[model samples]
Target: MELGKIERLLDRYDEGETSIAEEKLLREYFLSEDVPEHLRSYQLMFRFSASQAEEKLENKPKVVSKRNWYSWTSIAAILIVALGIFFYNDSSRMLNDNGLGTISDEELALQKTKETLHMVAQIMNEGKSDLVYLKEFNNTKNKIIQID
Candidate 1:
């Protein structure tokens, strides 16, 4: 409120050292209708500073340059090509005109066991369906004989 205090605050403000609360106080004091005409110029300064502070920054985050874009694109392309080449080479190595390498004895035995179990399951399912059809056929045959 005192002229000396206001002058000190103004000095702090000019040095960009004023806290937000201090700045608000300054703005309110300078904007009041009772403000002395001698201090009128300072009112404009605070108003401008406040408006400038509130302004939304233009080009926030800035545009990515073409060179940076090209660099990242080329890096991604190279990685993709490397991945493709690695997978292709690995697959090619795993295969040949004769097919993949011969299985180990243990692996062969396991495969044989899997195939046997699959065939057995298939046979059991087929027998179950056949039994169901036979039962139905016998019932119909008996009814026909009875009708006769």
Candidate 2:
């Protein structure tokens, strides 16, 4: 190829407007031993590309299917839904069976609360009686020690 034509192709290649055929021609021109000194710097780049194209991988690449990923994701979603349903039903059943369901009568609830509070009060009063005896014993011990 004429030097002028090669220079035009190089300009087009630099501008990223060259067709594949033009690029191939440039590569061939650069790879020749007769490349002019001014264009010799570009020979290494073309040689490197040619070498890369001819190079082969030692091991073939492994290919994974998209369907397998989808299957696992689907199974996980199903398991999560199943677990949620199971816990919801179990909790609802426990609430009804254990008499923890809705209590509609406000009066009955108030009466139950009063009884519970009364029981707690009685237990506290019994403890208070024991504390009274403890206090008397401590007072008598202190009086005896003062006399000695």
Residue 6 accuracy (lDDT) in model 2: 95
Point to the candidate with the largest TM-score: 2
Candidate 2 per-residue lDDT over residues 1-148, each given as its tens digit: 8999999998999999999999999998998989888987788889999999999998988877899989999999999999988877555555555476456799988888899899999999999889988999999999999999
Task: Please provide TM-scores, in order, for all candidate models, with all chains considered together.
Answer: 0.35, 0.54
The positional error of residue 33 in candidate 2, measured at the CA in angstroms, is 1.3
Q: What lDDT does candidate 2 reach at residue 107?
A: 96
Evaluate model 2: give its TM-score: 0.54
* Error in Å for residue 127 of model 1: 99
Lowest-lDDT window of 10 residues in candidate 1? Answer: 94-103
Per candidate, the number of residue pairs that clash is 0, 0
Steric clash count of candidate 2: 0
lDDT of 1 by residue, 4-23 (tens): 78889989999999999998
